[model samples]
Target: MKPSLRPSLPLLLAAAVMLSLAMGLRQSLGLFMAPATRDLGIAVAEFTFAIAVQNLGWGLLQPFAGAAASRWGFRPVLLAGVLSYLAGLAVMALAQGGFSLLVGAGLLIGIGLACTGSGMALAVAARPVPAALRSSALGIVSAAGSVGALLAAPIGQVLAEGWGWRAGVWGFLLLGLAMIPAAWIAGRVDRVPIPALAPGESPRMAVALGRAMSHTPFLVMAGAYFVCGLQLVFLTTHLPSYLALCEQDPMLSAKALGMIGGFNVLGSLFFGWAGGRWNKGALLGGIYLVRSLVLGLYFAWAPTEASTMVFAAIMGFLWLGVAPLVSGLVVEMFGLRFQAMIQGLAFMSHQFGSFLGAFGGGVLFDLNGDYVLAWKLGVGMGLVAGAVQVAYALRGAAPPAAERPAAA
Candidate 1:
């Protein structure tokens, strides 16, 4: 069957809004680490452990959420995520100790992210557009997803500074409420028809999983994705604390985070456009390479406000650009029937790295009294991942099995 030429504007807009809010608020959680830890007498490692748990939970449950969306519909999963998000923030706002923080910020928020984050949102965005336009569509949605951070980080910082950490969480709760409507709207993608299976393709999710797992390129991309999650999560979970330890003005972390969000928009769009015209695997590799170099340089210098902002801009541009490329690659390799689930599998690897990034960074800092070692590990792994990805892509990896013409 021919794919639809016209995209669904409402579905795309709704998905973008949902992704923006979900990611924006979650990323801003780092801002709370300093105040929440000091006021509640929780240690930094404990705090980051909660974040690590959040990433792990999100990673572990993501495939299930994606499968549920495949079997039931996107709406139910999305609504559940919004509710979980609100509950998590509420628990966080009212928390008096570590256990509540773990339950609220760690587990509940993890569940919410599994449902509402890039995997589900990008899958929704991919559905309405034709294959020709899919990459750019995913990019536009991914770009909009960055907008939430632009607003959320500054607002959370102001509220936390003025009122308390609780106030910042309460603000996040209010923002999360908007996701309900957005999810409902984006769920309209359920009405769009799935593309017919490619020749020799099986409709069963298990078969799709088997094929993707066996595919060499998919494995390579997913492995490199581990580095992607590690690098980003380290920054989001620790940058605020790192800055505080340096005695820089408290607001600089927020500003730097906001800058990353701003640049993420440009990066997502540029890569989205580029993915359409270039080898997505190579593009993914390039992003990883540049991002690693930027990270190394930034950490090598003693950070000033100017240098910090510049680093954030460059890193931000290189940030979520991976979302479009990764999502596009999954679709090209596997049909949309299980895009969410297969992508979820890759993201699980990313989140495991995220778990290490958040928790491991905290452990390293607690033990060593600084982040020098953590940054070094991240940069080294990222370089290897990028190189492998580039070499594989340049070798002209096979096209999607579904798209390949059959033998006579």
Candidate 2:
């Protein structure tokens, strides 16, 4: 059957809500790091280690989750993710030390994120829409995903300040309950038939994986994606601490994160529209380039409230914009049949960078008592990666031989 030209509103809404909740809660967890560590009597490095583990676990399990969704359908996988999220938050709220933190925030939430995050949610959004509208649709969902952060950051910050860090996690738990229904609604995408494969294309997942692995452009794109993970995770995990170290008001971090979430909506929409008209690969590179420049500018000077908010806005606009570009590229290069799994493979690289950003930053801070070296390293790497991505994307390479249909 030919895919519908218009998107399925119900599916899009459901996917968007699920993504929003998953991302919002996950991003805001950083706010709890300072207070939670203090109250629980753990070192900053120990707390960050759990977050590092979360990134690693999410990365490691992502491909498997995608494959499971492809085989069993999105509903079961999504529902399982919701339960895990709830359980993870519960453990986090009641935790007494690092072990509980690791099990709750690291293991369970990581497992939950693998199922509920962008890979699975975008894959669901990509179905039922025609190719022409896929990028825009994915963008819309990604924008919605930012909403959670907007609300969660401020709320978590307030609750943590007023009641305690545990209350803040409990707040997150309450927000997570909403995802159950969203998952059920998004699951409807499973009913949409997969697009018919081209002649000579194999239905097997391994074929798609191998084709992607051998594709030069895909490899380069995936490599550049590592920087995206590194830079973003560093900010999310450490920005609050960084701001606190500057002796800024506690609420400043919340405001900055909220600004990022708010601006992310506009950025996602603009990029989604642009991805349809421009080269998605080049657009991804530009976002990285601009983001690195912004990072350098913000960190070079002492942060004021005005500068911090401005930085957050700029960063937010560049944030999550990659979702549409990357998802669209995956579909354009490979096919929808294995989009989740293929994207997951690329995301593994991203997670590795995230691990470094979270754990590495914490270690650097403990060693130096400052974030100077960490930000410098992130800026340097981002510049190189972004430049390479832009240059390589302009090359306009053809799809790998395996992806092209053989002569009959």
Candidate 3:
């Protein structure tokens, strides 16, 4: 890496724009699942299974993709990722059977998302920023993802309602296509010098994967991330339906979800900034603790439309706020040379949680008449996650006599 060069502001903007589009389009896929299942003759679990496959596949592929990008190049991997993303959209739009849905939406799109999602965005952020500013830059990239969700949720709803779900899929396809130029802008306009591993540096991918897997702090943090995913995705995917059952309009439900995504941008940026300035683990613990309290309070209050909206806004502020700091911790402990691979490994835990959250929530709702138990379980998990992350922070600290080298 050239110590003299700085990542231009335009490059940052370009990266953020591309990331936003990719995130918005991918996230909007869930909005179509329930409606599509009803229109097609597929079972609810079948649709849920497709999404679960998507998450599992993405998680599985992310590390490899990061490795490839690390070894070969970012531009080619990014192009390939875009193709996979678009192909997934196309197949989903035309799918006539479960096979098509699984292949298109589940395998292909999942792999595509792995290559292009937060892992890649963080990598991009790491490349340009000064070491001291890494956490803030990472947060900015993460906030871009939330911005996509903030916009995409409501837009997806409108397109699905007005133009048809298929049209919405196609619209997202067009959006994905637009990412090509942004990628070009953000990536190699010239043959940039490749970053080199330090002298005595281990092979990048192996070290990252092995180090993260072996580390106790990483394990605890990653495990807690799993719980966060379970709670967040479960609620996001099904909250609209839950609200509707409580006599709220579907549009209102969509708005609530959108609001969650919207406020999350602020939360993500806030936590990201805080991570740079303060103890990230403490901040993360506090956020999770607040989440647990909020969930319990919402349950007790018994949601009316006004109260539900208020609760949503509160929950929204905390929702996905953990992302930047969680990823930030990986960089803090491991450094950014192998950041993508390390982060991807942690993300696998996240996806596993998402799989359980998405599918399990559906199963629970189908089995029982109420989601009360699920909500309660979510609160419990939040507390546990908070404790785990706090423990990780304390345990991961360097030896008292040792000082960390500054990142250049």
Q: In model 1, where is the ten-residue run with the lowest total lDDT?
A: 399-408
lDDT of 1 at 67: 97
TM-score per model over all chains: 0.97, 0.97, 0.90
Q: All candidates' lDDT scores?
A: 0.93, 0.91, 0.74
Clashes of each: 0, 0, 0
Angstrom error at residue 186, model 1: 0.5
lDDT of 1: 0.93
What TM-score does candidate 2 reach?
0.97
lDDT of 3 by residue, 1-408 (tens): 543224456666666777777776666576776678878888666777787888888888888887787777777777788789889989999998778988888888888888777777667667766766767777776776677766777777888899888888877787678778777766662244434544444554675566668777778778887877787777666776676667766677667777776777788788878888887877877787888888788776556777777877888788756777876777666665666788888888888988887777777777786687778888899898988788667665651111123123
Q: Evaluate model 2: give its lDDT.
A: 0.91
Output the better candidate (2/3) by TM-score: 2
**Which of 1 and 2 is ahead in lDDT?**
1
The list of candidate 1 runs beyond 4 A from truth reads 1-7, 403-408
- Between prediction 2 and prediction 3, the one with superior lDDT is 2
List the RMSD of every prediction in angstroms. 2.2, 2.2, 3.1
Q: Write the per-residue lDDT of candidate 2 for residues 235-336, one digit (tens) a residue.
A: 999999999999999999999999999999999999998999999899999999999999999999999999999999999999999998898888888878
Most lDDT-accurate candidate: 1
